[model samples]
Target: MRALLVEDNDRLAGLLVTGLRRAGWTADVVDSLDAAIAACRTHQFDAVLLDRGLPDGDGLDMLRALRDAAPPPAILVLTARGGLPERVEGLNRGADDYLVKPVALEELVARLNAAVRRMRGGRRGPILVGRLEYDPISRAVTIGGVPFDPPPRERLLLEHLLQAMPRPLGKEALEERLDSFERGIGSNAVEVYVHRLRRRMEDMRAGVSIETVRGVGYRLRAVD
Candidate 1:
């Protein structure tokens, strides 16, 4: 798994990075909130290990910005503030998990994996259902283990839908997730992608189905 570690203490940061690597994960370490935000935008990470104290401001500031991100990565606050109020505040601010300092590497790794497991609904691998699988890492889809590459937008649309499994997603929500902040979406854009994706799935005889709820939104489901 890929991670972004935002901690100002040089020695601590190095230790954490080394520990993460030893645990079989690659991490990019940044010392400030600004660098953390920039790295987040430039790179896609499965989780972010955040320290509450930074030179510029509270790391919670970065947490707020990240919550607004599309498919926001999992966030785990690793700080020295162990007060009950502090833990409550961090979780309320959208942290997937929170850990106090002087934590063991084994416990940290376990907690991080637990956070991701909760986000993924206990699934550690791809979003799999019968013959179809959507791999989050590569943004790749396979049916009966056969590779299927949809158009870029359609591919992203599928990933978003699968991530939100068992929840019917509205058009407005899909548009916000797929479109860049500066890009204005056309009225029929979402419908077109949905329609195309549905047809592609049909033609492939895939073991998945996209269901449209009248006056509501679309949902992806595993079929028999």
Candidate 2:
């Protein structure tokens, strides 16, 4: 998935970008709040890793601005400020999740995934659709209680589709949701992922079908 990393510390920002990449995310690093706001306006990201302190202004303000937008990206605030009030204020201002400094990379990734999952209206954990269940945290999918393996990108694509089940999502819209702000994906990549995912579902006898809408895009329909 695509992400925005708003951090002023150059070293930490680099580390965060590399770590996010390893976790199947493309992240754009910005050191200032203005850049963060501009990036949010110009690009689409699945999530934003926001640091509360920035060079230009408070990251909380940026978070508030993002929340006020027509369609704000999911936000996970990263800060060294461990005060209870700060955490409470961040959540009250619409932050999806929060992580203090010195957090393990794995934990940060987990938090980001959870934030995105909730932003998509996913349940508390793995989402179940018909005979298939997908765990966003474990990055695992099971059909009929048997494990089904798919590539990471395909798994993420399936998660997105399953989250939007029964709703027809235009192809372009799907791409934007899957895209990270660091790199632009080709138009056909979404179709390619969907095609592969469809075959996998069929092979596993999963009672879920990805329906195509011709000029539109796709949707997941559960068959009981």
Candidate 3:
């Protein structure tokens, strides 16, 4: 999953970004509310972790603006203010969840997972398509009950495609979800990964295929 971390504290932001990447999430850290807004406007993220206090402006205002924007991503507020009213206000402003400072990395990951799960309408865990099953928490994929070892980026690509199963996802949207602010991705990188994944799935005799839309994008479909 791709996430945006809107925290002004440089040290804390770095730590959180590292921890999130280790847990299979690509996180982009922005120190100011203005930068955060700009990031949200330009890119798409699976979730956003907004610190209530930013250097230039209130994080709550940023969150409200994000909620008002077109195609808003899920927002989770991270703050030191662990009071009743503060939490209430955050939620009222469209924060999906609130996390207090000095939070455990594991808990933050779990909460983020829960937020995404809730947003997906509480779908059953470990997405299944044909003979393949993908577990986001474990970051594992198994085909015909046998595990296939795919690199992290490949796995991330597969996860995104599976999440939007049966729907055609344009190349631009796929790239937006896969690229991080810190990483430089090639224009044809998505095609390369999709080709690799197709071969692997074929080797495993998985009853699915990644279909190209010819000038549009791709789709994951079950093959009879």
Candidate 4:
């Protein structure tokens, strides 16, 4: 999942970004409300890790704006202020979840996943694409009821594409998302993973396919 992190503390933000990336998520960090708002305007995030206090203004102000976004991201507030009243106010304002400062990466990720699951109507099951199924929680892949384990990079590539199923993702965007997970990617890296994934799909005789759009990018499409 791709997220936007609204934090002012450099150390904390760096740690959050690293941990999030390690946990199979891509996040962009912003230190102020203005930057956060600008990011919200530009891109759609799966979630937002917001800090209550910021250099410019209270992060809730940005939250107010984001609440108006179409299909707004799940907002997870990470704040030092965790009084009951503060939590209530945040919730009333539109936060999906709230976390106190100095939180463990594990808990943060878990809560983020919970919020996303709630946003998705509590779906934590396999993602279906024709005859293929990809489970986000287990990082497991299955084709025609047969188990298949894709390499780490390959798995991440497929997961990313599947997350945006039915909609083609730009080649450059897909490459950026994959690079956030593993580095040293060559120019044809996306092609290589796609090719391997295709082979696996055929091996299982699955009805799923990743279609390449000549000038745009690739999309996960199910065949009849």
Best prediction by TM-score: 3
| Candidate 2 least-lDDT 10 residues | 176-185
Tens digits of per-residue lDDT, candidate 2, 1-224, equal 67889999999998988898777776789899889889888777778888987878778887667887666788988999879999999898888988899999999998888887778677656778879997766667799999987875677677678767667888877777667655667879998989999898988889988888888788888876
Query: How well does candidate 2 match the true structure in TM-score terms?
Result: 0.78
What is the per-residue lDDT of model 3 for residues 67-141, given as tens digits with 9 covering 90 to 100?
A: 776666788999999899999999987899988898999999989988877776775678788799888656578
> Model 1, stretches more than 4 Å misplaced?
124-224
lDDT score for residue 108 of model 3: 95
lDDT (C-alpha) at residue 224 in model 2: 60
> Using alpha carbons, what is the TM-score of model 3?
0.88
Query: What lDDT does the true structure give each of the candidates?
Result: 0.80, 0.82, 0.85, 0.82
Clash counts per candidate, in order, are 0, 1, 0, 0
Cα deviation at 119, candidate 1, in Å, is 1.9
User: Model 4 clash pairs?
Assistant: none
lDDT of 4: 0.82
lDDT of 4 by residue, 136-176 (tens): 76556788878877766677788888888778888787776
Candidate numbers, best lDDT first, in rank order: 3, 4, 2, 1
Instruction: Write down the worst ten-residue block by lDDT for model 4.
Output: 176-185
- What is the per-residue lDDT of model 1 for residues 73-192, given as tens digits with 9 covering 90 to 100? 889999999999999999999899889999999899877767766665665577786578877644468988889888666776787788788888898877755553224468889999
